[model samples]
Target: MTTPLPVFAEPWPEGVTHRYLTHVGATVDVTGGGDRTGYRCTGCIYGSSGQYWHENVAHERAQAHAEKCLALPRPTQ
Candidate 1:
């Protein structure tokens, strides 16, 4: 079985964006083996090389996005 890819290594690529795709409970048998413990990315691809993370890596991905997402409530300086 292939190892699930890491999603939060960095933010989504420029021109590309994503939203909460799924909240998987556990890995299904189709993946050979799985955890499904993390978030997945889905949405418009930025360019031809855009990527999608279906593996269980949501916690990291969400944290990364929050750090950059100014739309969310921010602390007063």
Candidate 2:
């Protein structure tokens, strides 16, 4: 039987506390607790090019990317 892939565990940068799981097991991490927030996807090269003044905007962006990103979780070594 094939072993299950390990969960992603990269340390979040300061202020980043939200992690949104994608459909393909990838992650979209959001940074908050400040005037500006942003998101970065672990499965694809897509990410926030600039800080978002609204937290909800960042969340929405993350969710949108998660819905379409089909990249599988990265391998852990």
Give the best candidate by lDDT. 2
The true-versus-predicted C-alpha distance at residue 49 of model 2, in Å, is: 2.7
> Residue 26 in candidate 1 has what lDDT?
17
The 10 consecutive residues of candidate 1 with the worst lDDT sum are 24-33
lDDT of each: 0.31, 0.77
| Model 1, span 1-77: residue lDDT tens | 95563354444433333333222211111111134333322321111122333434444554444334323222225
Instruction: Give me the overall lDDT of model 1.
Output: 0.31
TM-score of each: 0.24, 0.69
The runs of at least 3 residues in candidate 2 whose Cα sits more than 4 Å from the true structure, single-residue gaps closed, are: 1-14
Clashing pairs in 2: none
Residue 40 shift from truth in candidate 2, angstroms: 0.4
